[model samples]
Target: MSPKKRFEFAFPDIGEGLAEGKVLELKVQPGQRVKQGQTLAIVETDKVVADIPSPRDGTLVSFGVKEGEIIEVGRTLAVLELEEPDSGGGEAGMEEERSLVGNLETATSAELPPSREGREAAPAGPPVTAGTTAPGLGQPVAASPVARKLAARQGIDLAAVHGTGPGGRVLRKDIAETAENGRPPAAGRVQPLSTLRRALASNMERSNAIPSAVIHELVPVEELVALRRALNEGRGGEGQVPRLSYLPFFLKFAGLALREYPLLNAAYHPQRQEVEQFGEVNLGVAVDTEEGLAVPVIRRADGLSLPQLQAEVDRLAAAARGRTLRLEELRGGTFTLTNYGAFAGLYARPLILPPQVAILGLGRIHEQPVARGGAWAAVPHLPLSLVFDHRVLDGVYAARFLRRFMDLAARPQELLLL
Candidate 1:
């Protein structure tokens, strides 16, 4: 008589040197038949939430970890009763198991193996709010990932938005209409901070420890505006440049300005008691997302052309807003740029983030009266602010860097030469 065949699926390494993650959702139950490559669960590690797939066709005998439990790599995730008996050739079976082990290590950022039915695999999208629902919370409402993200961003209640999808699932288009039609905002109430918000709070607390000083200036950007207008006219089409913002100009100018003032592109290590300067300019762009603030880095910003920089910025910003940035994209930034101009603020005292000694903020560009040719004329001016570690930089150097930066910004012709 043949023995019962069982296969234990362990939580494989999901890359990023992450050793542990919290199980967000369990799709299958005990005694349920699951096909190979079917999504079994969603796991979140270090802010990266990804869907975990079944390794083989089997009946889910039992779940090793309950939802909301943190699990480490190599820990058994589930025990499955195989649909087919194990072949008598032990060597071939072991080889097949080894291949499955490798497949388990893949992440949303990587090209995943094909699924059994070839469904369009959804990549790691928006973040799911963490922590278990309170007792009697009525079995957590179900919504599509896009719908959840849109609702969160628009601050609309998911329950209030009528779902038109199958089984009353809220669709993205419905959420958009709800946002545009001015749905009633939620009443003010104390609520728990989300996983991403908690992390940001901790980081800001750490950042507050640094002795920082802020300085501001108004950069005349008439030429910059004209240049952008000219470029857009030349394109002659909508969405020719996906996300053509003033950011790429700021990034390019900052990189050039950093070359002249390398001290601004440096970090300070308190324990080492030394300032480390970097030749390569890795710019961290602060992106405001539904999940809180995310700073995705642009490596070697000094080398990328204006168009390339625009593309990279658009890609990272999309990923960040969509909640798909990997761990590496969030770290190793030598300098930071925060563009509050996109929203509302006119000027802000940006804070220094961690080991990085400096942060630059670009505020809204406004038309103001200026003395030109002995006559008052309205011209566009960008509000600029720079915050730096007091221990590493003095006001004099900061003033000098700002002067050079503004000069580059004023002369768009020169900036393009770089």
Candidate 2:
């Protein structure tokens, strides 16, 4: 053996405050040839499942960490022998130019070309640079380990599923949606909780430590509905203008209400046994993704207009699902909003995320019989659930906050002006 020379790629800071990640998969073995930017493994952090790509064209020597092993930042992931060995520049010099966490691009939907085997082919524009889908090319079908596992259990080949993720990457949602359409759910199966799921469970457990109270109310939203419809009509184009919905209205109303009742938008300092009220409103919007729930924050939401807020919400939601959200987008949320009503729920006693004293859940908007002009008439009503930390806010204060929110929600057009 001509002097053993190799390059070791260490895990870098994949996300803000992410100290480590669990190795969920390994895409190459010893002696296997991997192209630069090809996926080498799948790593799962608390926030999302991210693909780890090879830093250079090389032959894999060995992986430092095994599957399901938690590796901390700055730890070597793998060693590889470069195809073109440097004569003067040593391994240290070559490693300095490589990005360990690079090539992890977001998946975007593209028109699938004619199938080679009656299945949707990869994008037609050009060959994928990050991860390959063709056999003998590189890794086959870039997807999260969870997505691949689910596809295997369903007897569905990943290539057949349409990928809407960045660079035509297949996602867990794509697999789950395909499985639901092709085969019914099996009686049951035992699978380990993902990092995202485990993190959510732990957070929920922590939330239970806080004594919370939930207050339910029904707000008339006929005016809100009409306002939204009219606003959308003027600027209604798919993926163009921000789609107006009752959500933007609710968010605006909540922010305005928070200004008056600052207590509702505060974090509790348990160590000091006091409430810490924030000067700015950083609202967390709970988004459901294939991995799990991610709350991306809208920084200083109070300063944003209805249109601006709508666009930010849309961008954050897309980023959350695509696993492309940054660290700052995931933190510093003074308050939270979860819309269970979007799934046809009447109301849900939403849990208060620890430290944050309150969380508001929006129930389904539906037509119900309400007294109008002293007569029972069918009108659209919105169900609102306000859950607050009892230590920080009394029931009366919580009720008052809701009343202020409803006062703004009832006059939806007025909010549009703001």
Predicted candidate 1 versus true structure: per-residue lDDT over 195-257, tens digit per residue: 456556777887899999999899889999988887766463675655457899999889888
Question: Which candidate wins on TM-score?
Answer: 1
Give the lDDT of residue 246 in candidate 1: 88
| TM-score, cand. 2 | 0.68
**Cα RMSD for predicted model 1:** 7.3
TM-score of each: 0.69, 0.68
**Candidate 2 C-alpha error for residue 152, in Å:** 6.8
Cα miss at 222, model 2 (Å)? 1.5
Q: Name model 1 segments beyond 4 Å from true.
A: 1-22, 27-40, 52-64, 68-190, 236-243, 271-274, 416-418
Superposition error at 185 for model 1 (Å): 13
